[model samples]
Target: MSSTDAPRRATIADVAREAGVATSTASVVFSGKAKVAAATRDRVLSAAAELGYAGPDPRAASLRRGRSGIVAVVLEGHLRTAFLDPVTTAMMDGLTDGLADLSSGILLMRDEAGDDAAALANAPVDAVVLIGCSGRARASLEIVRARGLPVVVIEGEAGEGIPRITLDNAAASATIARHVRDLGHRDVALVTLPLDSDRERAPVTDARLAAATVDVTVERLTGTREVFPDAPAVSASGSFIDEGVRVGRLLLADPAARPTAVLAQSDLLAVGVIRAAEELGLRVPDDLSVAGFDGIAVDGISDVTLTTSVQPAVEKGRAAGEQVARMLRGERGVTQHFTCRFRAGTTTAPPANR
Candidate 1:
């Protein structure tokens, strides 16, 4: 043969011929899901070794059910910016575990896929999971729905007859807000996640709340207002420490108008607020109290335990994944709800003058 001419890759047929066994028998040995004689299995294995065969390629098998074996996860911000939150990573772990039966891989797609949808449109994904089913996510959901793909929404609404994995954002936020109120914090302000798809950092205005698309942010804000009816709120661009610091400074810049306590929507945001308080020469719980949501460990704010709500983030992701799997199996998916537990910590205290 010429140097450019190469031999065809060995196949299970070649190995079966070498082992003097039927192709079906050889396949069973490779699948290992059925019983076969030890001698026969050993013969097949030895033949496979001699032929340099590495079992069957899963790529062809994965398509047998008309599934690409890839679950596309659509998230609200840029993939790089969104993964900075520990909650996303934790949820991803649970999602991976829940989809293990499918042996599927995850495809992380950003909500802003309109500008460049070549990847989203052409990618051979079996199902789509929208992290939040609002605004841009809704658009993506519509695109996939048109393609007749199974979808699961986490923490956002996708309309009627769709399985949703929701969280008690409103109730949990209300509970923590009541905790702050019980601590004699009358002058309190809220640091919120983004209100809309724009994710602009600004003061939480009435119009903005009315037009909010992100359900989690809206629910948490509504819950907090249940306790502090008139508490001022500011929106953060994202759930990062830097956004928290910026919002914290904006809320606590003037001692004359500074809120006695600040309620952040996330732990990283809370830590950022605390760091800002330190930057402004204010001691936590003494001059200013800060609390956050999510039960994840934050790196900064040394020794300061956050007063916050711990939600089952990972479980939420798992539930979404399981629901998607159910839908893929032609079964009706069920909606699941999760609640956050309030954890009182040293970061919050009664108003100093109280």
Candidate 2:
């Protein structure tokens, strides 16, 4: 054949012909399955190069294998929120490390408020990891379960037949509360994470308390009450620094009714409370002591380290990954609970005599 009329492109059949072998042999060589002589393999490779033929199509291979080769990591909040929280980052890093053996890749799926569960239901994933899921996350999870895919929830409540990787949120919060109480702070206020999707910033009432959908919020709130039954609780829109500042200002505004100590749900919130205290010209631990959860590093706050609870976020993710691997191996995965350590920082001290 003339060069212009040469075969438009090399097909598997062309490669087999050029290699002087059966088409099935060429297929086996590309598939990397079955034992082929090294010389035959080299011939197939050389023939494939000469014919300009790429390897077998991945879509076709996936179809043959009956697997998507993808894992979906569903995030409860916006993507930006996940990036801002160091806990989420550490957990993700651990999960990725655990999944290193898998040839497939992880796909991030954000569960937006008001979106249907169809997206997750139809996603081409063999397994799923629910990251920081709240009550709204349950609906999508149900859909995933219906599809019969193995699921692992991180820092979420355990469902019937579902394995969970949980943190000691209550114990940690109680430990912090006990520290404040031991320091002579009888009156304490709480700045909590968003209780539900509405994310309203206001005083938490009986109604809102009953409506709380996030597991972490509920457990931490319960933990605090275990120590201070009558502690006043305020709900913030999120664990953001600005939200902390706003809620902190509100709680500390009233001199007569202000709490001597404030318990924020996350370190970011604690920092915001510290800023609000500075704005009001009140000295931390002397005017008001503040404590928070999550042992994350924050900048700009010198000598005023926050007394907080530190959870093994990366290890939690690693445990979830290991559980997923177990499920993939047809073994029932065990639920793992991690404990948090109470960190005494400079942000908390005895309440000043009023």
Candidate 3:
């Protein structure tokens, strides 16, 4: 047909009429809701192909079902920064897989972006998934709840009645800490992720600990303290290598008072600590032992594998996504907990000269 004379887009009715079947039968062929005889289904599909009708409009179907078919993935920081973390990437992949059956797409947004909360409140999404939520992210809970959307939080507490996919944060950190302690590292220091919404990089004082709103950071710190009550700690602004380097320099610069070992909350921070140690002419695990969490691959950072805890990041994300799907489908969402494995890399050893 000529461009101007082209026929209108084909519809299910068109396919049904051409296939000599009812419109509902044609729809069932597409929705896979009811069983149609083999010959009828084949005829309907053939008619659809000939008419160039690729099933009903997804948007139209969603409208009919009263759903937006969009899931908002709320992160703690900017998108660029969040994607840099391997854990975030892994979890996102899993979430995508979990929502595969729904044929839904993800909308990445930050909880505390200038107007993001308001925008999210108005977005036409079926559900929201909060990744490692902090106080800043928690502040937007009211907005999401107000929209009457299903919520699934991963590694963050959103209070009762909200389904959460949690990790064994304290237990996993404790296991790693015990490994360091067993290495005869009497004098050690802790490098932590951000403790609160302020994202401060300074010594962790009791006041700051009490005010911390980041559940993951607080839980890891609790595990470390359980092993070393008197060990000094510095909270990095975020989980970036630069933040780790800055805090690492502060903790490792003073040779006289420098601890024999350092435990970082993330592999990136741990690598930064190693970089700091090397810049100060200290050999990792020889002059100053270093340990980290998140068993992410760090071949780019160093050859010395980082001793850390390997958590199922992708599974955590998938669980959250599955829960979101369930809630959206009028099913009860259940809380799930995951564990981590300890990796003994070359980075950790007995304290030098101890």
Query: Clashes in model 2: which pairs?
Result: none
Worst lDDT window (10 residues) for model 3? 296-305
Question: What's each prediction's clash count?
Answer: 0, 0, 0
Q: Give the total clashing residue pairs for model 2.
A: 0
lDDT of 3 by residue, 1-354 (tens): 788896899999999999999999999999998889999999999999999999789888888899888999999877888988888889999999999999998999897856887788788888999887788788777788777889999998888899999988899888888999999888999999999878899999999999999999999999988999899999998887878889999998888999999999999899999988888999988888888888887755557888999999999989988999899889999999999999999988887687
Residue 255's lDDT in candidate 1: 87
Candidate 3 segments exceeding 4 Å error? 1-8, 17-22, 33-43
lDDT of each: 0.89, 0.87, 0.90
* Residue 26, model 3: Cα distance from true site in angstroms: 2.9
Candidate 1 vs candidate 2: the lDDT winner is 1
Rate residue 230 of model 2 by lDDT: 91
Q: 238-257 in candidate 2: lDDT tens per residue? A: 88898999999899898888
Q: Rank the candidates by TM-score, best first.
A: 1, 3, 2
- Candidates' TM-scores? 0.95, 0.87, 0.92
- Candidate 2 lDDT trough over 10 residues, lowest sum: 110-119
lDDT for position 303 in model 3: 72
